[model samples]
Target chain A: MTETELLDALKAALGADVLAAGGVGHDLWAQVAKGRVREALQLFKGTLGFNVLVDHTAADLLKWPGGHWAGVWDPCQATQGGEHERRTQTDGRFELTWRLMRLDEKSGLVEGRAALKCRVSDGEAGPPSVRDLWPCADWLEREVWDMFGVKPNNRPDLKRLLLYEEFKGHPLRKDYPIAKRQPLVAPLPAPEGRIAPEQLRPRVTDPGLVE
Target chain B: MTDERDPQTPGPGSGALTQGSGPPGVLTSRLDAAIGWARKYSIFQYPFVTACCGMEYMSVASGHYDMDRFGAGFPRFSPRQADVLMVVGTTSQKIAPILKRIYEQMMEPKWVVAFGVCTCTGGFYDDYATVQGIDTIIPVDLYIPGCPPRPENVLQGLMLLQEKIQRQGLHPKPGTLRPPIR
Candidate 1:
């Protein structure tokens, strides 16, 4: 399906959930409803056959003017064989993207991407866990929770991944100070020559002078 | 009682430089050259990838500027057989000990190449969780600096290791300071 046709289908199916639909760079990104992500993604998968989940990663949406942005790539356009033996014409293929992709070789591929805006708040519930759909999403969502304080609800493991268990705040958020330094680990008796006293030794004067 | 030496075996004072003779420096140098050649041609490495720079490391190993041509192929899983440790990613405080253990498990005469800004000097994460530099725990032989260094820079570090091995014969430089040899 063409980009416009796919967008129309999404709007019709999702109603008020579809925010903005326009070409962004080489692909199409739709500002979507925060709660309707799974439904919108299922529509793209079931109707258009965008069955490949290229990658799922979250970006600090605060970079944008509106909200947090999560990106997912669709490999529905992937084809088999040489040009002469092409299975189908995918010259200017449209990648239908949401937040997830369900893989099934027999049905062919449909581009799917889903993005939901998240509010940065200690009080805000994390984005719903999509581990049931894509297991790797478990880690991705936990990272978001740990880095941005955006909790992914129903997540089995919500502990921090990049920071120590005692780390108090999410370091990636805009409000988090860039200069805050955590207390240093207790020194390890400094490697021999690195300490002041040991560093004073003179260099060996002969080639045969073993340490 | 001292045993008499055979006439054919020559006396201890003889400046004997024949095959299977004393002072194996020549033999050792030859062996070092061969190992040096192997080290240059095929530096099979186990990547301790952990952060953003790892992506760039993968790019170097993949297409564009394939490192495989020079024999520095990336092996994800660490096996004792691999001698070169390419710490291409960040090391956390929790993971630092693990990295040290992995380094120790590697056979002797192993070389470590700290790739990218993080592994080289902790990049900008001078915090508690992330290790400031891998060298703090493991002895690093080469440091490649870049926030997320390009593939060419990684290859440059590999070449630098090769040059060091060829010139120094992979033996620690003589009289270059050491912990008093017991």
Candidate 2:
């Protein structure tokens, strides 16, 4: 289906859930209410033949000058570059973006791509996990949680994908200090267990520890 | 009968042997100088390479530049066997501990050479992820400064390290600190 047809179908199916919808280049783009993310993605994947989840990531819109939603605005659009007035909101938030693509089954070529985004309020629950629909969402969601602290509801394993276990705060967050250091006190023991036997006889008794 | 050539005065053709004139055949030199000569030419290096700087390092080690001529051509994969640690790229905070562990595992009398601007001073990445300088984590013996230093600069740095090794005592006295390399 064409971009407009799919968008019209979505608008008809999810009338109030979609806040805004339009075309950006050849791909269709939409902004939807955060709670309806799963339903909207399900419709795209199951009914519209958009079987592939191209990419998934979140943008911290806390300090964005254009607005919370402006973070995801396509810069390539002709109407985007004019002098715009800022609409400052008291509450900080994050915008979660997911790019989906449809492919022809026989040729294995991409037929269409659509960009969908939703606003996730900071300190609140994030959009539902789409791991069941697209297994690739597993690590992507984990990375979002790790970097932005946006907890995806019902995610089975939400461990930090990039940072170590002891890392305290999400470093990508706007509020996180850039120079704050969290040096490890001592090296963690090797995960593979002991590799060599202890020496029974040694020439030097004192092997000093590295400072 | 008086000999034409005096015993103390060397013959005209013996200039090569009589240049130092200390002894006829014995060549005397400081113990440190001899040890330094042997050590300078056989440095076994461990390259802790982890970024774009590795490209430059590869060039230095390859045939055109030939890092082997400086005695640092052989890269020891294990820390225990290496005498020099050449950290060749950006070291992130995440990798700092691993770098430290590798440095500690190397045997004593080992030296460290920070091989790029990133490893020496963190380059343009002055952020939380990058460890500003590797010297914060471990002592460095020499630093080669460049975004990705040319092979010629690396060779010059190697020569500087050789000079440093040549001046050190064979066996350091207890509690005596080796002079720091500028």
Candidate 3:
């Protein structure tokens, strides 16, 4: 289906939950209410046949003016480029995003793709974990939690994946100090024993040496 | 049981180099000098390599640079067997304690050579994650300065360590002071 047809179908199905739908570069994108994200993502996967969860990530939006996360016209979006501008703002909140792809079963080709974004406020719980629908979402949700400190509801293993357990804060957050160090109090034990140098001995069977 | 030759006389092939005719064919030197000479020539090194400088260290160990000529060719993986510790990269604060432990584990008569600018002064990583200098943790015998020091510079540093070892007396404790080299 085309971007418009899919979007219209979504608007009809999700109604007020579908806040805005438009074209982002060559792909269709939609911003939904944070509470309705799980339902919207389920519709996209079950009804629209966007079965493939291509990627999932988040952005910190703390620095935007008055907690107003910058949008397409914002100068901060220009740093990366125009293509990324549409999804750059969260109005002083975290923007959680997921890219989903629709693949044709017969041809084994990608028929369509869409980006779904949801604004999650600071200290507010994020969308429900999609791990039940897409198994790959397990690690992706963990990564989002690790980097942005966004808690995905019902995620079984939401521990830190990139940083060590002793790491104090999420590094990707804008507030995290760049130069702050959290060194370990004690070092891991090293292997014991002495390694001797390789030994070299002449062969007794050598005719020249035997004589 | 004495032969006809006089004990006071310089023996054949002595070439008039005998001092005070102390003993024929016997050379005399201080105990410290003899010990220093032996220690200077056999430096078993433990290369605590963690960054890009390890590439240069590889070249120094390989046939072209020939680190064996300076008697520091054997790269001991264990700290217990090594006589010298060559720290050769950017040591992060996380890894500093490990380096300290390795330095402590080495037997007495141990020396440390900071083999790159990063190991010596943390190089460009002047941040909280990097240790500003290894000396804050353990004493460094020599510092070889380079982004990733050239193999020649590493060899020069090794030679300097050898010279230091030769000039100083071996103390019973590992980190004891010795008289300054002239």
Candidate 4:
């Protein structure tokens, strides 16, 4: 759908939940409630003609101070050289960002973005799994889990993504260390001589422990 | 009745032969040395590739100076099989310990080749979550300089490793770099 049509449709469907709607260079964005995300996006895809699930990711903008939101704004519509550009609230929460490309054939170049502020459980836990709607969200969700330590419920593989298997802390957290590592044990030596035994030897240290 | 003039030419009887002065000795000894050298150089790496600089590390293994041709094969999935630990992307403080454990799990004589700017010096992410330099925890052998170096740059790092082996030799010494305690 056209930018105006999509914005109007979201405003009509979600009402007060659709916080802001606008276009930024070659892209459009709409801020909505977490509860209305699936339905609102469905409206955009089924009715508005945005078919492709271009991308899905999340950002943690926690540096902003309290009681200082200039109304929720979409980065896609953020202007480059505006005299009245204001900073939006960057509170420590998962701002779920999605990019949708219009596929009406005639209006295929148009793309839209929608940001939903998800209620992070325990103040830092990630959003609920979007895997049921978007299967590709699995990798992206895992990444968010690995980096931010944000656990999205029902994720099949919530283990570390970029970090090692035994990594301790989440590196992408706002408070990761400058330089440090937990203690590690050296590996045992390989068997000597040519004929390596068929049976494996037990490791010297506890295999359960991180090396 | 057999022609003895061209000994270099393989004959039915001379199944195993060599042009060197010495006899064809034990094949097992040669096989052992070959295996030893292969294990020494071709360290199957498990690159925890993340961020921008991982691209440069991939180039190091690509065509031109292919790492596979020179012994360092492509990365492996299991840490048990891999001999070298290459932490290619930016590591956070939380993940630092995990990277360390992976390094520790690699068998003895294992080497770590620190690739790119983020890993070697921690580059722009020298902040709270990101670890400044991975070398602070693990002993780094070769540090390739670049924010995201070219693939040839990785090959250059490999060549530098070969030079280091030529200088220090492959076997670990008493005090070269202390192995992890127990």
Best by DockQ: 2
User: lDDT tens digits, residues A163-188, model 2?
Assistant: 77778999888777755667653423
Q: Among these predicted structures, which one has the highest lDDT? A: 2
Candidate 1: deviation at residue A185, Å?
A: 5.5
Candidate 1, A7-63: lDDT as tens digits = 678789888667655442224446555566666656655686555445544444333
Rank list by lDDT = 2, 3, 4, 1
Error of 2 at B138 (Å): 0.3
Worst 10 residues of 4 chain B by lDDT: B173-182
Off by over 4 Å in 1: A24-26, A61-122, A156-168, A179-211, B1-90, B100-120, B123-129, B138-182
User: For candidate 2, lDDT tens digit of each residue in B33-138?
Assistant: 6677678789999999999989999999999999898887899999999988999999988889899999889987788899899887678776657776677677
TM-scores for all candidates: the values are 0.48, 0.79, 0.64, 0.52
Model 1, B1-182: lDDT tens per residue? Answer: 11123345554422121223335343222455555666666676888888888899889888788888777775747648776788888877777767888888887657788888888657766654677677667777777889888788888877777666554555744222112221
Better of 1 and 3 by lDDT: 3
| Reference contacts preserved by each model | 0.11, 0.27, 0.19, 0.08
- Model 4 reaches what TM-score against the true structure? 0.52
